[model samples]
Target: MVASSTTDAELSPTVRVLDPEGRDIRFVSALDPAGVVAHGWLRASHRAPDAERTLPYRPWHPHGRLDPLTPGAAVPLDIEIWSTSVVVDPAGHRLAVTVQGRDFEFPGEDPWPRSYGVDTKGHAIFLHDDPDDRPTSVFGGVTT
Candidate 1:
């Protein structure tokens, strides 16, 4: 008799948004289909209490040049992926997703989230609700 085992690496890159099983993950973003497709970055961090770690991406406006996401140095439990096309609906609006699986959603009218910011020069930056923390630059490269 022979025994075989399948590893995580053996699975396909395409993630099933909705599975027959109950296991699923959720994400929030206001990015439209094009924006999501262009700059979709997800990550999981203790810093983010609610959002699990996922890949990271940048959002770009329509008719604008797309920017590459700044890669993190740490390894993730799952592989990081970038989208090739921003899925859209018949109305031409960015398809909003809010499923309990590995998908993204837009939280319209919700409070701002705590996130790290990066500048063009590639410096680390944090957001502060208080005016006191406001500085000349968001990061070394991004000046507010």
Candidate 2:
């Protein structure tokens, strides 16, 4: 893993992707100055073992492939996050994630910025919002 020089004050909570064996495959932070906002490991469906075992409805491409974080490997991923939403682009092998502002204060009366994710096609996936009691869905389409 590349060492980060950013301090806690400059770093936002990170979203991590782990392999099937629970190994850290890749991670991304919104705090990055480069606008790298998000990234994760990916592989073509044909390269993945038993791809049909999960989510049979999704289509897989035999020629598609995502560059592995490691030099050479086919890694399956499990996504995890503390306070962000992630969107995957299966065909493009990309991940887009939401990141709350570093100044955001939770469980307080003050207003804070909201964070959200977008799919490869640019559809919104809401992540953070005030009034925590409101019912919501992760798959909820863009709200007006």
Candidate 3:
């Protein structure tokens, strides 16, 4: 994996995407909080096995694929937070996630701007890219 110098203070909602084996598929540094990509045009990307998925915006892709607003596209949550619910939008194509720690804080100014880790439990939803796209797997070790 490419060593990323980007920090968490710059990111609004940060998070990490882990595989079923508990390996980090990718890191989403800015989208960790509840308000980051909650609205507007954004992207979300991920890879599961050989599939690399990318969404252009939120509210579900009209061409089909992943539509969180759609009835069937809702990824069942095995985790929850704040008594509130969140869904993965079909529009946002996740790219990279930010790691926790560092000297940055959300909703605050910083000497060095960076992204923060998002709540990766129930909000940790992403699209599994299908074949025909690049299929190299990216992995990260577990951290508490």
Candidate 4:
């Protein structure tokens, strides 16, 4: 997550599983270019990890209460991409992880922004292009 869009908001975004051929690798769903490998949601103010429940590989958020964020607060989040086993072709296949925003759209794909987070009209059903969740002022900077 970049920065808090509001005092308290719900952030729901999907991590796309990509293939070398410009296609989202999908095992299910009939939606075109649907390669949603992992998805998770957490309140902007409820990102604290549960010490007892969190593991080395997976993080557990207590979600017991809300701790709203200060506007423009840069928050660090731990998003887990479910473990997966993939055999890549030696020719040109590659396994990589890239953090994507809502501006990305494939050819012939829906042009509208589609995100159902706190405040959204629901544009591209699966594409995570919610302006409310991603403010250019926050995401545009280089993160360490």
TM-score of each: 0.17, 0.16, 0.17, 0.54
**lDDT, candidate 3, 28-115, per-residue tens:** 3344322222212111121111123323221232333321222123222111111223344345434334433221223333232223
**Model 4 TM-score, all chains together:** 0.54
Provide the overall lDDT of each model, using Cα atoms, as 2-decimal numbers: 0.25, 0.29, 0.26, 0.51
Ranking by lDDT: 4, 2, 3, 1
lDDT of 1 by residue, 36-112 (tens): 22222221211122133333442222322322223222322232344544333334233323212122333344333
lDDT of 2 by residue, 66-124 (tens): 33233233244332233446553334353324333221222333233333432211111
Choose 1 or 2, whichever is better by TM-score.
1
Q: Candidate 3, TM-score vs. the true structure?
A: 0.17
lDDT of 4 by residue, 1-144 (tens): 556455554455454545667555543333322444444555556678888988988878877886766676777777554554545555654444444433233345344333444211121344343566555554333332
- Which of 1 and 2 is ahead in lDDT? 2
Which parts of model 2 have CA positions greater than 4 angstroms off? 1-15, 32-82, 87-144
Ranking by TM-score: 4, 1, 3, 2
Best by lDDT, which number? 4
Candidate 3's displacement at residue 61, Å, is 40
Q: What is the lDDT of candidate 2?
A: 0.29
